[model samples]
Target: MTTFSRRKALALAGAVALATGLAAATPVLAQDCEKVDLTFTFWGSVNEKNDIENAVKNWNTNNPCIQVKPMHIPATGTNYVQKLTTMIASNTAPDIGYLGENQAFQWATEGKILDLSPYMGETPDQQYIKSTIYKAGDTLMGTGLATGVMLIYYNKDVFDAAGVPYPPAKADEAWTWQQFVDNAKLLTKDRSGKNATDPAFDPNAIDTFGVTLPSWWGGWYPYVMSNGGQFANEDGTALTLNSPEAVEALQGFQDLIYVDHVMPNPTQTSSLPTGDVLMQSRKVAMSMDGMWRVTDFAKLGINWGVGVLPKWKTAETVVLSVPKVIFSQTKHPKEAYEFYKYISDPAQVGLFKSGLWAPHEKAYFTEPDLLKTWVQAEGSAYPPEAMDAIVDYTLNHAPQQAPVYQLKNIGQIMSEAVEPNIQQIMNNKATAQDAMDKAVATAQPMMQGRW
Candidate 1:
C-alpha cells in the first residue's frame, strides 16, 4: 500500500486530473467462491474508490458464492459513459457496474441492464424505499443502494471567526433566498476588513467570497430548480431549459457573481479544487454542493456543518442516487441476480452507509435507537441530526426532474453554452437577461437538433 503524507496527499489532490486510467488487471482473489469472479466498474476519486472497496470487502466475507473486484475508471466526468459504452461493445465490460441515475432509465429502455424486479420481489427485508428504486418512467429499476443530496455546507471555523450564526440544520427551518443573501453579505469581507455593505469594500480585494457556485451541471441545477424550471419535461420527452422560469433562475445565478460581485469568476472557480467551489475550505463562507462533500471534508479534518438549501417559492433541490447495476450481458444470470440481491440486503446496505453513502433505508431515519447506533458506529464524520434533516428534506421536498436526458449531448451543451455564458455573467461581461438570452438561443436549436 502507498502511504500518503499530508503534503503528498494535497499535492496529489491538487495535481490530480479527474480522469483516471482504467485498471486492466482484476484484484487477486481474496477468498474462493462457488460463483465466477465479477468485476465492478466505477468512476470517482481514490477516496471514493476506497469507500466502495470497503463496502465490497464486507460483502465478500460471508458470501462464499462470489468474489467481486472493483475497477476504478478515470474521472472523465460525463465521459465515463462513453468509456463504459466502448468497454461494453468490446465485451470486456464488468458484470456489475455503476451508472448515472438520469442515464439509467434510458439505458433500461435499450435493454442494456438486467431488470432487477424479480430479485427485489423475492427479498423479504425492507432494505430500500420503494420510491427511490423507481426509474424515470416510474418503472422499478434496482434498489437505490445509496443516494446523494444537494445541500448547503458551511465552514464552522469561518462562521465562528466571522461571528455569523451557523446556518440551520433542518430543511424546513432553512432561510429564504433574501435572508440567505443577507447572511452571505455579512460573511463576505474585503482585504481592508470591510463587509459587502461598506462603500469602501473593494470587490477586487475581497478576501472571502460569500459563496462559490460552480458552473458544473450539479452546481447549476439547483438554480434552475429554484425558479421552478426543470431541465426536461415531466415525461422526459423534451428539453425545457429555455423556459421562462429557467431563464429567470439562470439569470439569478449569473447576478450572484457578476452584479453582486460576491463570488469568484468562472476561471477562478474552475482552477479551484476539483472545479468545486465548495471545497475551498475557509475561502468560501457558504456554498451549495452534494452530500458527498462530507466524505471529502473528512479527509481535510475540517469542522463543517450541513444545512438545508435556502428556498425559492417552492423549496427544492437535487436528490439523486446512482446505484450499482447488473448488465444485461452477464453470462451467469442466476448468480448475478443473487449478488444483486445480496448487496441490497439491509445489512449489506448498512455497510455501504458506514462508508458515508446515504442509506436508502428509511429505518435509519425513523427508528431512534437504530439511528443513534448508526451515528455512533458509521456516521462519526457527520452529525446524525444533520443527516436526518437532509434525509427528511429529500423525502418531503426532493424534486423529481428527469436527469438531463432531454438533451442528447448534455455534457457538451453544458460546456459550450451553459458554462461559458455563466462564466461571462460572473465576470460582468453581460447582464443576467442578456447572458441567458444568448444561452437559450444557442442551446435551444442545438439541443433540438440532437433530440
Candidate 2:
C-alpha cells in the first residue's frame, strides 16, 4: 500500500495550488443574459449546510447570470425522501438536489430525473470515479457528490491501556476475525476492573465496550462479501442472503455480542453517547463506521487512529455517497448542470477540508500530487495512517461499487425484509440462519434486476 508522509505533503503544496487554479478557471458569464435562479436542495449538518451556502454565494458572485438559491433541508432518510416526493408530486422540485442511490435509479427510470449524459461532455467516465457515477444501463442518471468507505476507528489510549496492538492500518495486514474478537475481549472492561476475558468479568456492569457492531447493512455487508457471501446475485435478480457463507458471517457478528461479550448490544448502545463521544470518554475502545467520522473524531481531540476492518476471508469494504442529480422539471438544464459540476469539484466545495468527504474523482487516489491535495495536508483532520487505511484500502481492497450503488429496489428490500430480519438476529430473537432464510423468502419477490 502507498504510504504518505508529512514532508511529502508539505512539498506538494504547489500542486494543490495549481489544481485549485485549474478548477477555478471555469468561464464566467461574459455576455449579458437574463439571470436564472436555480434552487439546490440537500440535507446535512450545520457545518455542511454552511459550506454549501458559502459555495453557492461564491458561485452567485462569479456567475451573475446563473444565480443559485440554496435550499437547506435538515432532515435525511425517510423524512427527506417524503419531502422530496411531495415536491415532485406538486411539480415544485428544485433544479438540483442530493438523492439516495435507490431513489436516483428509481426516479431516473420513471423519467422524474434528468438524463445527465447529454450535459456531460465526452469522456465523462474519465472525470469521476466510475463507481461514483450512477447510471441506469446506458443512461447517466446522477453522480455521487463525494465518496466514503467503511473502516475501523480506534482510541489509541484505550489500546495502549489494554496492552493490545492497534488494528492494522494496511489492508493486506488486516486482522483475521478471531484476532479482532480476541483483542476486543481484552479491551472490554467492567466497573470492577475485570476485562471480558476474565472468568469473573461482569457483562452487565461494563465500563468500556471493546467495539461497536453496527446493525445497519452498510456496516456488516462488507464482512459478508469478505466471506464470499452476497445479499443477492450479481445481477440482483435473485436473493442469496441465506447462503452458508452469509449466514456464517452474520453469526460471527452476533457472537461478538452474545458469545464473545465484547461489543455492546442494541439496548446498551441506546443509552450511550454517540461513537465519537464514546471513544473520547473511554466508554468504547473502537468503532466500525464510515470515513466521514474523521471530522467528528478530530474535533474532540481524541488520540484516534484509522484501520482496515478485520477480514473473514478477504479484506473488503463498502464505498458509498449520496447521488447529486438535476430534476427533470427544471427549466434551466444548462444552468443546473453547470452548478452541479461546480459543487462536485472538491476545490469549489470546502467540505473536503473538514474530512467529511473524499473526492469522487479517481485522479485524487492514483496521482501522487493530487492524492496529497486531500489525503495529507497541514492541520488535516485525517489521522496519520489515513492514506494507507482509507485511500490505499479504498483503491485496492474495496469493491468497485457496493451493492447499494447497483442493486435495484434495494431500499424497499431492506426496509421490508432484510433490516427487520437482521434486527431480529441482533436481538437474539432468531438465529442468523433462520433470520436470513426468512429474509430471502420475504425479499425474493421484491428483487429487481440490477442497473
Candidate 3:
C-alpha cells in the first residue's frame, strides 16, 4: 500500500469513519433460509482476514447446522464501501459484517442493521465496556470485539537524557494542564542544547519537539473534557464545542505548536502514521496517541514509557471501540447473533495480548490475575505494571464517551465543518474561539436534524 493509503487507513485505525449521502440500505425482499448458510464479511489485511476466519472456525465447531462463509472485501479504491453499499442495496448483504460502530448505528437509524437485544441473554455480570457495547437510547446495536485506549506515550531515553522525570503512571499523580505544558516545554530542545524555555531558543529550525498534538477529535476530545468542556450536550442534541471552556482547551492545545512552540505543527506531522514515527525517530520526545499502536510500535524497538494524561477540572480521555454488527436483512437472525456473539467474544482478537487493545471486560480491569492474561502475555510489548494505572483510569475514572457514533451523521459534520477550523487553529491562522464559532455557524443547522 502507498504511504498515503497507509496513513488514511491508520487514521481510521482506532476511531472509525465513512460517508453520508449514500442512499439508506434498501429493505430486503423476503427470502427463505432453510439451509441457513450465513455470510460474514469485513475489510482487512490478509492476516486480519485469517484471524477473523479462524475465529469463525471455532464458532462453527459447536454450531454444526449454521455454516458461515467468510467474505473479504477486496482492497481497491474504497472498495469495501463500494461492495457493502451495493450489497445492502441489492438485497445481498452479508448476514454479519464489520460495519464500524459509528456507521452501523447511523445505518441502523435508517433501518439497515439488526438490534441484537432480543437475542441477547440476560445481562451477564462480566460484560464489555458499557459505553461501547450499548447504543444511544439503550438499544443494543452490536458487540465490541476489541478496545482502544488513548494514552500519552513518552520516549524513555529522551526523558532520562533531559533529566525530566517520566510522566506518572497513575491518574492521581497526573500533571495538571499547566504542569503538562511546562514539562512539554522542558522536553523540547534544539540541536544547540536549547529548550523551548531558553531565551535564545528558536521556534523554527527546531531539532526535537516536546510533543505532537492531533487535530483529530479523538485526540482533542480529552483535552476538552479535561478542561470541563463539552462538544455536545447530554444525549447528543446540541453543539457546545464553542463554549468558553472548550475554546480555552482548544487554545491550549494549539499553543503547544503555535504559542509555547513545544510541539510539531500540522505540516510536520502530515507524514504517515503520525505520532509513533516522530517518537521512534526521536524527532518528538512524547506523543498523544491510542494504545492500538502496540501492534506497530512494538516493532520499532524504541524504549518508550506510558504516562497518564494530566487532569484539569478532572482527568478525562476519549473512550471508544469498533463493533461487529448483524444486518437486519439476515434471514437467520438467531444464527447471525450466535456467530456475532462468538466473533465479539473478546478473547478472539487477542489484541489485548498483542498490546493493541485494552481490557473491555470488567474482570480484566478489576481482577489482577485475570488482567495478567493479556498484559503479561509472552513477549508482550505493553509494560504490565506501567499499564495498570491507565487501566484503572479508564475503567473507574474515564467517562464513557459517545464521540461520532451515538449521534447519527455527526462524523459528516465533524469532517465538513469542524476539521477545517481545527486545522486553522493548528496553522495559527485562527483562534480556537473564532474557528469554533465559524464551525458552529456552519454545522448547527445540519446537526439540528435527527438524521
Candidate 4:
C-alpha cells in the first residue's frame, strides 16, 4: 500500500467525495446500508432527541441494512467543540454531526470534515430569502439542516391588554427606531398601571416591560448593521465597535434599560431563564429572539405573535445557521452520508411548521405548498400574515452575514474583546463609547491570528 500522510489523505478524501458524489441524480453508493449502525452526534434537549428519532425512523423503515443512531453529545459551547475535537483527533468521532457557524468555518477549512459536494444532488436555487445558507465557499462544509432568522415574538394577550396594535411583519414597513420606542412606551406598564411614557411611571415598579432582546451579540448585532455601522472590516480582522454607528447601536440598547427604562435590566432576568417564559408569564410583552423559540411558545399554548425586527436606520436582522458536517475519520462514509442527507433534505419541510426550524431551501421559500408545510401552524407558529412577511419580506431583507461571526477564533475574540465590554454597557458599568473603546483596545491585537 502507498504511504499517505494524514493531511494528504484528508485532501484526497475531499477530492474523492467530490468525484463520486454527483450533484444531480447521484445514486446512493450501492452498499449494505443496514448492517451498518452509524452513530450521529448532536447537542440539544429531549425535544431534539425526539425530532432526530422521528427522522431516523423515517429513514430506517425502508433501509433495514443501514441504521442511524442519534447520539446525544450532552455538551455545549466550548465544551462541545473540545469533546468533538478530541473525538476526531482520537479517530473515534461519530460518523456525522452538527457544526456551528464558528466550527463550520474553522474545521472545514482544516479538512477535518467531509465536503458534501458530490452528494448535494442539485445545484442550489438562490432566490430564497435566506440565501447563502452555508458559507462553504468552494468546499461542501455541510448543508445547514435548518435556517433560522431573528425576529420579534410578542404576546398577543399583552398587545391586546395594552390596547396596542401588532408590530409590522414586513421589513419595508418596519417600525423606525423612534416609532419602536414609542410603541414600547405604550406597551410597558407599571404595577399601578402607568405606562412608560407617563411621568409618574417608575422604572423600579415596572410590571411588564415593553420589549427585551436576548443578551447575546446576535440580538444587538443587527442594531449596528441597520444603523450603517461597520463594526469591523468586511473580514473580521479588526474592531470597529467604537465607530459612531456601532456605538449608537450599542447605546440604543443601553438606553432602553437605563435611560428610557423600557427594557428589563439584565441583572433582573436570572429568574426568568428564557425569553419564552418572559412572554408567557407576561413579564415582558415583546421579546426579540430567534424563530426557534416558536416551538417552546407553541407547546406552552402562549398567544404569541411574530413580527419582523424593528429597524433603526434600515431594516435588517441576523441569520442564524447551524450546518451538518461528516467527520473525515468516519469508517462508514456512505452510510453516514445517507443519514446526513435524510435529515438535511429540504423535503423534510415538516420541521419548519413544528417551530423547531425554518426552511433552508429555496423551493420551500418560493413554492407556496412547501412554505406552508414549514410555516403554517394554528398556534405557537407564524400566523398567515406573519408567515407571508417572513417568506416575502424578512427572509429576503435580513443581512447576508452576521458581522460578529466574520472571525477566526470567534469564541476567543468575543470573550476577550466583545462580551465583557458589552456587559459593561448593558449593566451600566460603562457608557457605550467607553465600553466599545475598551473592547476595541483589547480585541484589536488578537485579530492578527484571524483567517
lDDT of 3 by residue, 316-408 (tens): 667666767888888888767656655543333354566655655665565544455566646666764445455776776667465665565
Q: TM-score each candidate.
A: 0.78, 0.91, 0.80, 0.85
Ranking by lDDT: 2, 4, 3, 1
lDDT of 1 at 273: 62
Q: What TM-score would you give candidate 1 relative to the actual structure?
A: 0.78
Residues 129-229, model 2: lDDT tens digits: 54687887666876777888898999999999999999999999999999999999999999999999999999988999999967888878888999999
lDDT per residue, candidate 1, 252-342, as tens digits? 6776776666777876776666513353456788777777656666566667677877766667767666656888788876655555555
Give per-residue lDDT, candidate 3, residue 43: 67
Model 4 clashing residue pairs (backbone): 21-118, 23-121, 33-65, 33-66, 34-65, 34-66, 35-65, 353-374
Query: What CA root-mean-square deviation does each model show from the true structure?
Result: 9.9, 4.2, 9.8, 7.7
lDDT tens digits, residue span 1-451, model 4: 0113322433453211111221112334444433877778877666666766776676666566677777777765587788888888888888888866767777777878787776664444353335334544566665666667788888998899888888888788889888888889988999999999999998898888999887788788888889989667766677888999989888999998888888888778756557777888888888888777666666667787788888778888777767778887888887777777566543432456667777565555654434444675333255656564566654567755664345666756678789999999889999999999999889877774334
Model with the higher TM-score, candidate 2 or 3: 2
lDDT per model vs. reference: 0.62, 0.81, 0.69, 0.71
Candidate 4, residue 18: how far the Cα is off, in Å: 16
Give the per-residue Cα lDDT of candidate 1 at 359: 55
Which stretches of model 3 miss by more than 4 angstroms?
1-83, 121-128, 136-139, 346-349, 448-451
Considering only N, C-alpha and C atoms within 3 Å, which residue pairs clash in candidate 1? 19-75, 20-74, 20-75
